[model samples]
Target: MTFRSFIARTRVLLGATALVLAGLPTAASADVVFQSVANPTDVTKFTSPWCSSCSNQYRIFDQFTLGSASSVTGFSVALYSLAPYWGSGLNFSIWTANGNVPGTELFSQSLGNADFTTTTLTGTALMATTDKVSGLNLDAGTYYVSFYNTNLAVWGYTGGGGNLLQQGNTYHTGTSADFILTNNVPEPASIALVGLALVGLGVARRRKA
Candidate 1:
């Protein structure tokens, strides 16, 4: 092919790849994306290893906004246990953010009562998908997901000894870092749009050729 023809073909291929990727579901697209999340260092960086004697609640902060109003169905918790959830019997309280800093609690639920299970190969942490938590409508604004009520360890980053959460009449710090979690579903409509985008890409390529 001539140099000009080769350049055109390369552009088409790159455009096609970009279109395909744009359709894929990503954390920012359809998942519970965290804000100011701590980086994972090691398995031993588990925060809140034990809340048995603790009478306070600790919650991390996340600021998420949507292009349009949508309902958040559920989330997944990052834990650091060597055994199954039932083996250690872990539970947590789910909350929806309201104000700023430590935000006001809008919704509440027992994480144990909801569906929970390990998602990865090691089976260290648990993930409860949709149908676990009820629906909560979200719009173009900031929000936070907070949890407490168990002694389970969480894969967190850089909040262990610094006050990251507050409960009762006191502000508490992390044992190591902040808890890592996200509870949201990629809406079926969004998934369908992605598929359509990919298909359209094929048509566009054929037309370009």
Candidate 2:
């Protein structure tokens, strides 16, 4: 074969290799979005700011049943407190809903004054902490997670306060809090399906040749 033809063939081989490499598995491409389970009739993730009046987070679970035989394995929630108050803390809890009443307590955590800071707060610390309820074995059902300000007297903050008030006395109300629910578990057959598809494509290409 001519030298130019040999070079062309090498280039084609390199391009194919690159395409296969691109499809290789990597941690960065893993799925981390909320997804429904195969057996669950209903699923819901709830979150909000930590405050006494923020009862919407609590009432949503009143209408649904949560926690079935197949408990959520990779469910997670992130809590963020936007206000900057000294000695302020956030109290959060997870509950399974059973016909307008919160049933089992899944998990709970409290961030003391040290866990929150207005000076350098950006909602990173809360997100980085893994959910304490990673692999609970409960039934699948509608669930409600709730947040509250357990230390209302100490961590309470109201807007329109005068300048330079006491710690936890500023007008930094809990309006900037948010939560995200995501499914971390991969479908049992997803990997097998992808592998089979790739293999079939290769076999078909060979038969054509």
Candidate 3:
């Protein structure tokens, strides 16, 4: 191939490489923490802040049900707090629901003072954290998630006020904390394989030309 043609093909290969790299999954993410054996029934992802009428030691309560068997590795949440609330530590936990409210405690975990980090969200300031990993496995039923032990964060909503259903599915409970759970370690997305195919196609087209 002439030098100009060779350069053009090289650029195509590099561009395709960039796209694939961008789409590849991270080594780990609290976002895609685990794979589910069965879909979570009445699934909803929750996040809360003390938007109004919240007090010290406020408790968050949310519930979800699994269709089959699953093991939850950890949880993560969007935490909102002001300067006054920053402190030495924060606590979180999972529990069973009684009449769709916080009930018997099942598992609990704690965070160091510095673990919480902040970012701007929707023109609001908030602190969010990575998956606080745990060793809780749940069955084909319902359970509640709660975030407590902080004087600094907002309550987002009270008693199921701001929980959102996963786009098309109904939420399992009326109210809960903002958190995501993982059943196993995170996995790569199928898009990476698609990227490889695209790269192959681009190389083939260049050769034919």
Candidate 4:
């Protein structure tokens, strides 16, 4: 081949290699969905984008009946920050609420906080405190979980108030983050329920005989 043609072919091969390498890192960072293995009532997980001004993620747990009369013995909540930027360098704070909004009561019991500076998308931070609702004694009803950008100074970089990061929106400023929620499984109760059903079936067959 001529000198020019050889140089052109070499450039095309180099460009293809560069594109493949560029895509590998993003493939590694894609978010993972956490699946529940036990009772759906016993465990729940939710995820949403971490916006500066808006509540990106919200969950209403009608299954959980909490009050002075009923108590959740094995209740647990785990929060995971999935922002690629936070894992890289950007800093932000996340907050949670058991109710909806200014009128709703926020979770002040301090489950815990996670910094994703070094962890990958698979990395997670946990707050495994037991009887999380005992102290708060939240009323029996639905609850809401929200995340906000606590650093006003940093959020200001997005041109100040109301420019919150949205889910699936490409970030033009700094990095955006996501959140994850996880609950513990009620192993004993689930196993017992299954066992009782089987026993009941056996007894009914013997009586019929």
Indicate which candidate wins on TM-score. Answer: 3
Can you list the residue pairs that collide in candidate 2?
62-100, 65-142, 66-142, 67-139, 68-139, 68-140, 69-139
lDDT tens per residue, model 3, 1-209: 88578768778876876676777775554434322212221222323444221444245455566666676665545555455454545666667767635568888878776665544343333445545456766666766665656454533323443342221223434444444565445446455556667767767786788
TM-score of 2: 0.34
- Cα lDDT tens digits for candidate 4, 1-209: 66567557656765655565455432112221221122221112223323332242322111122233322222322223344322222221222332422224445333322322122223433322232222332344433322323311111122211222332343333321222222333444454555556655755565566
lDDT against the true structure, each candidate: 0.47, 0.37, 0.52, 0.31
Every model's TM-score: 0.45, 0.34, 0.52, 0.26
Displacement of residue 5 (Cα, Å) in model 3 is 43
- Which stretches in model 4 have alpha-carbon errors above 4 Å? 1-48, 52-69, 72-102, 111-134, 147-209
| Candidate 2 per-residue lDDT over residues 1-209, each given as its tens digit | 66567557656765665566567543322233322222111112212223343332222111123333543323322333344422355555557655544668876666555543232223421331223334444455665444445323112112211111122222233221223233344443445446656755755565566
Ranking by TM-score: 3, 1, 2, 4
lDDT of 2: 0.37
Candidate 3: residue 10 lDDT (0-100): 73
Clashes of each: 11, 7, 13, 0
TM-score of model number 4? 0.26
lDDT of 3 at 84: 49
